[model samples]
Target chain A: MTPESNPILIGSQRVRVELIDRPIDRRPLSDFIRDPDTGAQAWFEGVTRRMTGSQQTDRLEYEAFTPMATRQLQELAAQAMDAFSLTAVAITHRLGVVPIGEASILIGCSAAHRKGPLAALPWLMDQIKADVAIWKREHFAGGQSQWVHPQ
Target chain B: MNCQVLLFAAARDLANSERIDVEVPPPVTAAAVLDGLGRQVPRLLPLLPACRLAVDQAFVPADFPVSAGSELALIPPVSGG
Candidate 1:
């Protein structure tokens, strides 16, 4: 079953932030960001790559300090909306073991113009990587797993 | 004073437990809790400096007072994209 979550509204944007234990559906956010006046909608989906340098990664395990992470994500969404003048944002990250080629994260953004949505999507992702309290462990083909984090 | 030290990710791996209770002098501080934790689990000593301390879900400074029964999470470097 999909992990439990609720939509959050900040400013004019309806943000979907969740720490799910199952696969993330891209459709919901796509539908949420639909707008006739909005000329640009940018979506980003991060998937588990099969290879990491010379090592082949079979899967990735994710864990989260949920409450703090959720709080930080909401702050990020609100900041993104204010910073880039975005109309909507939706983000979902997966927990538990995710096999190769599956979506580990999904970020969607919409704006009245292309510039705001385009700029906000990638910036939002970078902020999540740097600030969120989530972790990733890569399981290699040699049956060894390594915990990965940013310096 | 007593506070619950919660471990996550690499900190959890190093300590081999998700939670550890620590006792400190009156008016416990986050640094004292870290010192106490390092003393109890020597393996955590090297990693403690890099870990971020959060009390009751808010990240706090080393000198931040840890209230009784509060949960302190040790958040190591994060890489979530």
Candidate 2:
């Protein structure tokens, strides 16, 4: 398959952001920001689950307003890097169909001290959920589906 | 002039298309775009109140002037992590 449309869209010396259409493997994500000066690397993975409040999810499909999402993600990474004094930060969000147990989003942050990455991880996640232009449609068992609107 | 408003998530489902082209008058504002969509795609209007408008990949106020060539998107409340 041609991965042309889903390659890493933004990157710099300390920041990388991607809107990918495939599964997010956490191995490389953890290693992405690690280096000799890095004393702490914080990682987060958002996985697709089979259940959400008693509904049996068969799968989850992700969609994004690609241009906006990409730009926003890049901004988030940069902001996190600056705010947390991070050595590097990486984020990958998936698009299209994702099976249960697969990761839909991955975030990694590395810093010279533990507090920097640790403090930045959750804050960045919350910001992404609040600001990014991405959505998830949950396909339920027995052929029903619904868009996940936050309450 | 005509400008296309891109739809996403719930808005896309309501409109039944990824985008809708609206015929707008001169000095097209975000309000005018939504008004046009309400007339053309009535199904999309109910959700418009909860959504935000993005012009050229950036969020803007309802009074923001949007050119025909600008990329417009209707942003529903996000659910990404």
Candidate 3:
């Protein structure tokens, strides 16, 4: 099935979880909003950072147990769709080594009213971090790297 | 019965072997396989606390049963976005 047919909104969106190595398009957000006849589409893009606390970070690497991870992410999206009155949702995440200032995750949601999608955006992000099977490894400037868990 | 156990991520890198053959009694459970693995590959003991197991590509908790010819994978903590 196409991404539009099974659009992912909150949990690790379709683009991020299924298309791990491909680049994501921003147009999906606009398209979803248009299709839903909504007045507003709230979007959030999580970018890689150059610094972590006092230490300078070189890059971030991500690895996943592909099959199980994808299943878990899809389940999350379905849950969000049922909980919130959403018209359409799009989510994308990048795997492998992501450089600083690059988008790692993109989430968009459309609803009849602005308040629902707006409030649900952050809540969805939190659920993704907490329940998703993805993991993040931070590489420091001095060649030290550490795995970071969702908090 | 002899079955092959697959390792991934940090556990694979540490063991230096993708698959190992272990002998177990018939109708073994996933937990029993892990116990046998620890005895055969002592190095895996330290990493067990942080690892998970999968059967036939699905995550199975310790109590899950194992059948002969089942594919088992040792999954370390994942680090993906």
Regions more than 4 Å wrong, model 2: A1-12
What fraction of the real A-B contacts shows up in model 1? Answer: 0.84
User: In angstroms, how far off is B46's CA in candidate 1?
Assistant: 2.2
Off by over 4 Å in 3: A1-17, A32-34, A146-151, B1-6, B17-27, B69-71
Candidate 2 chain A weakest lDDT stretch, 10 residues: A1-10
Candidates sorted on TM-score, descending:
1, 2, 3
Candidate lDDT scores, in order, read: 0.84, 0.83, 0.68
How close to the true structure is residue A103 of candidate 1, measured as C-alpha lDDT?
93
Better of 1 and 2 by TM-score: 1
Which whole-number lDDT from 0 to 100 does residue B56 have in model 2? 89
Q: What is the interface RMSD of each candidate, in Å?
A: 1.0, 1.1, 3.5
Tens digits of per-residue lDDT, candidate 1, B1-81, equal: 766788988788888998987777766788888888888889988878877788878788888988776768888888787
**For model 3, how does the per-residue alpha-carbon lDDT over B1-81 read when each residue is reduced to its tens digit?**
787988755566568897888886756887888888888889988877666677877778787888877888776665444
- Ranking, lDDT, top scorer first: 1, 2, 3
TM-score of the second chain for every model: 0.90, 0.91, 0.88
